[model samples]
Target: MYVIHLRYTGALAEIDDALDAHRLYLEQQFDAGAFIIAGPKIPCDGGIILAATMDRDRLDAIIAKDPFSQQRLVHYDIIEFNATRLAPGLNLPQSS
Candidate 1:
């Protein structure tokens, strides 16, 4: 699994301007089943994304396609880990 942390580096105005394209990019990832879940940070300063198990290079390519990355409005910190457990009835990949 992967944890994608996105922190805004630009002003809110710039962030807003790029939000739509960013969302579109996110939607594409979801459609491709690369993304599991995502949302804005509680403080709205950034966002977090949970992604299914996959190659790091593929994930990096996906991130590079993000509008925020293209516009230089946000920074990404990606962490890869193995899923050790899940809630009852919940299903997700467990391998690193």
Candidate 2:
């Protein structure tokens, strides 16, 4: 699994300007089953995304296509971790 942290590098106006395109990209990822959960940060400085299991390289490539990334409006930090524990009712793919 992975957690993606995005920090805006540009002004809020620029961020707002790209929001629609950004949302479209997010929707596509969700439809492709790559993203689990995503939303803006508490302070609205950026956003967070929880992703399904996948290679780091593949994930990086996917993020590279995001509108924010393309415009260089945000910085990305990717963290990978084993799902040693899960909440009830949450079904995550397990390694064989």
Best by lDDT: 2
Candidate 2 at residue 38, lDDT? 98
Which parts of model 1 are misplaced by more than 4 Å? Answer: 93-96
Q: Lowest summed lDDT over 10 consecutive residues: which window, candidate 1?
A: 87-96
Cα RMSD (Å) between model 2 and the true structure?
1.7
lDDT of 1 by residue, 1-96 (tens): 999999999999999999999999999998888999999998999999999999899899989899999999988999998888889999885433
Q: Summarize candidate 2's per-residue lDDT along 58-78 as a digit string, tens digits.
A: 898899989999999999988
User: Each model's TM-score?
Assistant: 0.94, 0.94
Candidate 1, position 26, lDDT: 94
Deviation of model 1 at 36, angstroms: 0.2
